[model samples]
Target: MTSLSSEMSEPGANPLDTVERLALANDWAFHRQSDDELAAEIAGQWCNYKLWFSWHPELGVMQLSCALDIKVPAKKREKSYTLLALANEKLWVGHFDIWSEEAVPVFRHALLFRDGNNASIELMEDLIDIAVTECERFYPAFQFVFWGGKEPHEAIVAAMLETEGEA
Candidate 1:
């Protein structure tokens, strides 16, 4: 993990790409809590086992919560995925919706940001990590479209400039 100032000096580095375009994001942090800890934390509130493990330095926090729904099939539901942003602020509420299918856990390769279409390869690893966590919770597999650093996905990630999302 290079110093923030180091990246700041680079002319080509995009502000939004800092966390999402990282090649070696060694500074990011992750944690795994036990069921006892969970029970103690959310004793009264409704409990959902969609656990979260995350790392967000520029966003000032890298917290993940299994405190939400996994959006299982039988009917499609939207899952709000929290993504950190560093556009002059530490925290930004970004989202990606996982719509349920006939399968219990089917993750469609859908990028949910209008301005986040370019240079997102760094997010791949992060997304993979999150998806892996989701898989663990749901006892299912990811309906992976571009798992091995491949196209449309890779093209969007590799581009030096931003592309259209939904405009």
Candidate 2:
């Protein structure tokens, strides 16, 4: 990866192209928004999500964000906050959040590369996997708070419960 940054420093090195190639190799559908930005839609266990990634070659950082389909009702904003706080606690790499302007839930994570380091396909794929898995794992919890009319604690507990003897 060290050689990669050096090559990028040359006249024409498009970081977004590296991202596009990886997305194609993985057979994931994606669109290039600009020279520095790319977006993709992925299907998760509970719902589909839109992922946006921006590459800052100067800073050697990649910012990845995923927007879940669930939206918190205006009336349930407080409950949503409590649930997000609980969910964010267990997540080590990324955290769940509510976008105040839209009242939508989002999961975000960032990858920082040291000087001379470049982004790898594996790293990008893993980041997306983590975000999707976390969102699916907690989808039911949010549903409980918003539609089931359950308190935050009750919602999480019920969502985490495992039932046996299924029909």
Candidate 3:
């Protein structure tokens, strides 16, 4: 399978540009990919994004299926499992996702970077970063992340980049 991974950062992942979750977002794009050509090229299915809270404290990490209940702010707490595509792809995430009725595991990995999808992961990351940077300018509240792992969606969720806490 043509699998790949990438990291999305506002301002095209300059590395120099600093972005912190708690801090007010900067002027940037929110979408994961940018280039007009690339955007159009990815006409096929490419990415899926899921956001939630991790509940299994004993497990240390919670899976969406059995996430523990946490005090997710009524307004700020929400999640979605979006499949990234070309036609639907936007410069930004648009509106923040609304939480599901039940508590689910928090996003612990990058949005698109899975472990086995080496081919897809590499290519996708490049695109995701470009889009994400642009998204920041619009959606300052949304956070950019990758799919859990390279494992096909059928397999268990994995992590390209684990959502570790800030030190």
TM-score of each: 0.22, 0.83, 0.20
Residue lDDT tens for model 3, 92-156 = 43222223564332222223213222222344333334443332221211222122222122221
TM-score for candidate 3: 0.20
Tell me the spans in candidate 1 whose CA falls farther than 4 Å from its real position.
Answer: 1-104, 112-117, 140-167
Question: Which stretches of model 3 miss by more than 4 angstroms?
Answer: 1-96, 99-122, 141-167
- lDDT value, candidate 2, whole model: 0.78
Candidate 1, 30-111: lDDT as tens digits: 3234321111111112222332334332332333332333333232222111110111022122222343332232222223
- Candidates' RMSD to native: 17.2, 4.9, 18.4
Q: Which candidate leads in TM-score?
A: 2
lDDT for 46 in candidate 2 is 81
Q: At residue 111, give the lDDT of candidate 1.
A: 32
| Candidate 2 positional error at 85, Å | 0.5
